[model samples]
Target: MDETHRDRDAEGRARNARPRDGLGRPLPYGTEGVGRQPEGVVRSPEETLREAQRLLDGGMPFHAHEVFEDAWKSGPEEDRELWRAMAQLAVGLTHAARGNAVGGARLLRRGAAVLEAYRARGPYGIGVGALIGWARELAGRVEPPETGAVARPAGRGRATGGVDAAAEAPRLRP
Candidate 1:
C-alpha cells in the first residue's frame, strides 16, 4: 500500500483513540493535527484548572473544553461534578464564540444549575457563588452579534454589544 493510504488508516485510528472536541467534532490525525486528548491521563486539579484558564484567556474556549473534559473523565469521582460544570461552562463559551446565542445560553444555565449545590462550600477553592452568578447573568445577556462585525482584538471571537462582552473568559476565582 502507498504511504498516503497507510497515513489515512493511521489517522482514522488516532481519531477513534480519544475524546472528541468541544462541538463533538472529530479531530484530525497526528500530533500536529487537532486530536482528542489521550485517555486515562489525568492531571492535578490545580494544573488542569490553570491550563483550562489559560486556554480560555487565550480566546480558545473550545480547547479549554477539552481540558475540562479530561478532568471530568479522569479526576476523582468526588470532583466530577465540578469538572463537568466547568466543562459545560467552557462549551457554553464555545457556542457563544461561534455565534450560537441560544445554545450558549442553554449550556451556561445548565452549568450554573449543576454548580448551584456546590456554591455554599466553594469546592476546590473555586468561587462557586460568583461563577453561578456569572453564568446566570451571562445566560440572560447572550445575543449573537450582528453579521460583519469586527471580531475581538485578541482574536478571541466575535464580540456583541452586551452579553457577548461578558462572554469573554471569566476570571476563575481562587
Candidate 2:
C-alpha cells in the first residue's frame, strides 16, 4: 500500500477511537482537552472574547465555537449563558459554511435571544448586546458588507459578488 493509503487508514482509526457523548457520542472538535480552569491563573475575558471573534473573522467558525465553549464551561452558570450564546453563534456560522442556512438561522436566533436576556441582566450586558445584534443580522441575512458584495468562490482563490453565498446556503425548516 502507498504511504498516502496508510495515512488515510491511520486517520480513520483515530477518528473511530474518539469517545462519544450523549448527543450521539460525537467527538468534541478543535479543543485539545476539557478542564475546569484552575486557581492562580488570571482570566482575561477580553482576550477570550477576542480569540472567539478572531476565529470567526478568519472564517474558522468551528474553532471559534470551541473557544466560546471553553469560555462558557469556565464561567458561572449565570454568566455562562452569554458564552453559550456566543458559542451557538459560532456553531450557526459553521452550519452556514456547510450550506445549512436554515439550521444556521435557527441557532443564530436562539443565541440572539439568550444574548438579549443576558444584556438585560447588567454587568456583561454591553458585550452581550453587541454580539446579539451580530447574531440577529446574520440570521436575517443582512448584508455582511456595506457595498452589498459578499465574496464567493469564482473558481479558485478568486471570488465575485455575483454569487450570493448567503442565498446559496441550505435552508432547513424546523
Q: Estimate each model's TM-score.
A: 0.69, 0.55
Spell out the clash pairs found in candidate 2.
Answer: 20-25, 21-25, 99-170
TM-score of candidate 2 versus the correct structure, residues matched by position: 0.55
How well is each residue in 100-125 modelled by candidate 2, as lDDT tens digits? 55566678788888777667554432
For model 1, which pairs clash? none
Off by over 4 Å in 2: 1-43, 121-126, 142-174
Against the true structure, candidate 1 has what lDDT?
A: 0.70
Candidate 1 per-residue C-alpha lDDT over 67-154 given as tens digits, one digit per residue, 9 for 90 to 100: 8889999888898988899989988877876666767877889999999879888866788888888778777778554466554443
**Best prediction by TM-score:** 1
Pick the lDDT winner.
1
